[model samples]
Target: MTAITGTVYDSSGQPVEGVNIQWSSNEDPPVSSHERGSRTIDDGSYRLVLHRGSWDVHGTKDGTGTEVETVVLGADDAVVDLHFP
Candidate 1:
């Protein structure tokens, strides 16, 4: 298992707070029974723990969102930032 941490930004390059960071994996599932979501706080930062595999990470607020693909190696953490239009 590894911890993935990052921030979300808007189109104007401002931090986005109170947004939901959702992630799903095709090659590996969650390491535990935890849900696959992390919400950004006032600083737009979030952390999610996932097993080693490829995942599709997404950020969403209201009805708009953006997604990116990332891979995590065994026992290594990752950082993936997302930007929305």
Candidate 2:
């Protein structure tokens, strides 16, 4: 089990708020790779639990930009920093 942790920010270099994050598998349909889930927080940060597999992680603030990240993780903590414009 690995904890994918990261912080979210906007183009202005300010941390975003009320953002939505999702962690999914690298499959075509991309199943929910996070056991706890793909969600966001008020402080613009998120942590998703992932197993040993490839994942497609992304984040967005309603009405803001969206980011798509492809990561291959193993028995290590993955740090995925998110930024949007």
Among these predictions, the greatest lDDT belongs to 1
Q: Which residue ranges in model 1 land beyond 4 Å of their true spot?
A: 28-36
Task: Report the C-alpha lDDT of model 2 over 49-83, residue by residue, as the tens digit.
Answer: 77777887877656665577888888899988888
TM-score of each: 0.82, 0.77
Off by over 4 Å in 2: 27-38
- Where is model 2 poorest over a 10-residue stretch in terms of lDDT? 31-40
Candidate 1 whole-model C-alpha lDDT, 0 to 1:
0.77
- What would the TM-score be for candidate 2 when compared with the true structure? 0.77
Local distance difference test scores for all models = 0.77, 0.74
Model 1 TM-score (2 dp):
0.82
Error of 2 at 29 (Å): 8.9
